[model samples]
Target: MILVTGATGSIGRPLVRRLRRDGTAVRALVRDEAKGRALGCEFVVGDFDDPASIVAALAGVDRLLLNGAGALPADGEQPMVRQQKTIIDAALDAGVERVVKVSVWHAAEGGRLAEGAHWEIERHLKASGLSWSILQPNGFMQNFITGQGSFTADGNLVGAYGDGAVSYIDCADIAACAATLLTGPPRDGETFLLSGPQALTHTQIAEKLSAALGRTVHYVSLTADDMAAALISQGLAPRFADDVAVLTQGLASGIAAPTTTAVRDLTGRAPRTFDEFLAAHHEALAALAWAPSR
Candidate 1:
């Protein structure tokens, strides 16, 4: 049996569905009973902070998908480091055969936010003596719809990316890759960098959004300092805001513009393009309250 953490999240939701569709035995670890039931699969109420619940969820599970929330402003060190490390240790003790982890692209030592946190967890997972594969995905296309730190209060897309393009992959494709790794032969000690089929600038992204939503959605490019100040004004911690600005500013150099074939090589199909992603989520896009940038 496979146990999926963060089953209600962008990747986990599709992963669980794909596994179930293929008639694989899967269990979801959820924090809420209602959410668990909504998944329509075997689920156990569990929280990363609650070790006993996690232990209970691991029973009879051979494969594990390790994923959870990202860094928060209130965090001193990313909580995911402690939480995921605990799960790795427990999964080892539970006799789990393999684990698949979701990590961010550009994860390295001393990096900011999710990058640094994921690096720490990746090290822990590797040393646990358990078979593992890590998926280092670039930006998610879902961010445009969910506003994952990409939109202002008035729904304008705001960043310090200048004119650099990012090869943002769809979360569904990430889920498909995870499903393949979990259900197929173990890919121990391998890390895959996943991306969309093409790179796109924020200006191009805004154009796509305008066509899809039938309204002009603007991309506001600001300098690192101005972006940090805007985040501070929005009540984010100055340190956290500054880190975000620095990270986004790094994108201006086209660091994340590269695309990868890992998605196709794993799933035997090409990753979705930005236009495809926008079309698939048209209803969600229509529901968003984006206004024209002033």
Candidate 2:
């Protein structure tokens, strides 16, 4: 059986659906029974913080997708790092054959908390003695629709990314690649960089959204400090908010700007373009009532 962690997330939900449709025996490791049941998969209730739960979740699973959430405390032990170690240990104990881990771009750079944790996990996965494939994807296109680091006021996209271009892939593309890696021939010790077909700046993204929605949209840049304060006001911790603001500055400087063909190579189709993504999510974008400037 194939097991998927973070099954309720953007990538996992679509991945589960695709796997089931393809007739794969799938089990979802979820923290909540209701969400698990809603997924229509064999459910295992487990919290990553608890090693025993991870062990329980690995029972009868042959292949695993390890997609973890992004938040981790800076001043304390990294929960995700511990969870990854626990999961790998349990998968080894259970004799699971293959594992696919989702990591972010530049995970090895060792600055961002999330990327740093993923770097450690990648190292552990390499030494775990299982057939493993690591996917290092760029930022998700869905972040724009979900109101992550920025938003639109009237018809303008506001963010700290000044003019740097990003090759952001759709989350569905990431999920598709995960499904392929799990079911295809053993890609032991392989790493794939999944990115969109084209690189685009925040201004370019705004223009695409405008074209898709048939309305003019602008990109408004903000200073890192201003962006940090804005994120903090939205309820994120001060340190995390500041870190993210700094990360945006890094992105603006073109540190995360690169296109790749891995998504198309794995999924047998071109990665979704920004225009395609905007078209697919047009309704949601239209529904958002932009908050007025404070």
Name the candidate that leads on TM-score. 1
Q: State the lDDT of candidate 2 residue by residue for 1-294, as single tens digits.
A: 999998998799999999999999999999999999999989899999888888888989999999877754544345788888889889999999999999988897476757888999999989889889999999888777664556644647777888898898999999999999999988888999989998899888887877776777788799989998877776666777787888888888887788988998999999888888877887876666243332
For residues 1-294, write the lDDT of model 1, one tens digit per residue. Answer: 999999999999999999999999999999999999999999999999999999999999999999997646454455788899999999999999999999999999878868988999999899899999999999899877764456776766789999989999999999999999999987889999999999999999888888887777799999999998987776666777888899889988999999999999999999999999999999876666453221
lDDT of 2 at 143: 75
**How high is the lDDT of residue 34 in model 1?**
99
| Cα-based lDDT for every prediction | 0.89, 0.85
Q: Kindly give the stretch of ten consecutive residues in candidate 2 with the minimal lDDT sum.
A: 285-294
What are the C-alpha RMSDs, in order, of all predicted structures?
2.2, 2.4
Error of 2 at 90 (Å): 1.1
State how far residue 231 of model 2 sits from its true place (Å): 0.5
Give the top-scoring candidate (lDDT): 1
